[model samples]
Target: MDKEKLAYFKEKLLKMRSELIDKLQKKYAEAIDIGKGDGLDSADEAYKIYNRNLMLGRVETDALKLRLVEDALKRIENGTYGICISCEEEIEEKRLEYVPFARYCTECKTELEKKGLIRM
Candidate 1:
């Protein structure tokens, strides 16, 4: 990709990383607060447990996305952004624009999914 496009993607990825970090901090704070003693009946305790599990799942998802964004930034630094890691092909501009963290081109990604090597 051209320098201009690379810069654009870098900026976008940085912004995303920042936003995810902020979200993670907030989520962590919420989790801590939720862990504090909440005197309640069994029903209320069950509900709180469910909510805590849901929050934890969301935090895990966000953390995974943050790692992917960091990896994408590293790829950009190494001048490999916008290239599919699976097939060593240039990923489509549209795909990069939409995902920015994609490690595979559409075809390679599809093949991996079909073979159960990757999930959506």
Candidate 2:
């Protein structure tokens, strides 16, 4: 990709990374502030456990996305941002536009999914 396009994608990835970090921080704060409702009824205890689990899952997902964004930024620095890590081919522009942190082209990604090497 050209320098201009690379810069654009870098900006997008950085923005996404910032958002994910902010979300993770907020979730972490909430998790720390969560109290153990020792005196709560059974239904309330169940609800609290469910919400905590849901928040934790979201935090994990956001952390994964943040890592991907950081990896994409590193690839940009190495001049391999738009290339598929699995196939060593240039990823489609449309795919890059949609997922600026994609590590593989569609074909390679599909193959990995089929082989249970990666998940969506």
Candidate 3:
């Protein structure tokens, strides 16, 4: 990729990582008191547990995305951005536009998904 494109993707990845970190911080704050209160009926307890689990799951997903964004930044620094890690081919611009932190092209991503490898 050209310097312009690489710069664009690096900027995008950095912005995304910042936003995700902010969101994750808020989520972690919200999850701090998960199922904390006592004197709750069965229904209330169940609801709290469910909400806690849901929030934790969302945070987990965000954390994973954050890691991907960080890795993409590393790739940019190593002069490997825009190249699919799996196939070593130039990833489609459209796909990169959609997912700036993608490590694989659409074909490889699809194959990985089919093999139950690419979670989220």
TM agreement with the true structure for every prediction = 0.94, 0.92, 0.94
Expressed as tens digits, the lDDT of each residue in 1-120 for candidate 2 is: 898999899999999998999999999778655545778888888888888888888889889988899999999998889999988999999999999999999999999999999974
Q: For residues 11-105, what per-residue lDDT tens digits would candidate 3 score against the true structure? A: 89989999999999999888778858788999998999899999999999999999999999999999988899899999999999999998999
What candidate 2 gets wrong by more than 4 Å, as runs, is none
Tens digit of per-residue lDDT, candidate 1, span 6-108: 9999999999999999999999788767766568888887877778778888899999999999999999999898999988999999999899988999999
Off by over 4 Å in 1: none
lDDT value, candidate 3, whole model: 0.92
Q: Considering TM-score, which of the candidate structures 1 and 2 is the better prediction for this target?
A: 1
TM-score of 1: 0.94
Q: Weakest 10 consecutive residues, lDDT, candidate 1?
A: 29-38
* lDDT, model 2, position 115: 97
**True lDDT of residue 96, candidate 2:** 93
Model 2 clash count equals: 0
Per-residue error (Å), model 3, residue 106: 0.9
Rank candidates by TM-score, best first. Answer: 1, 3, 2
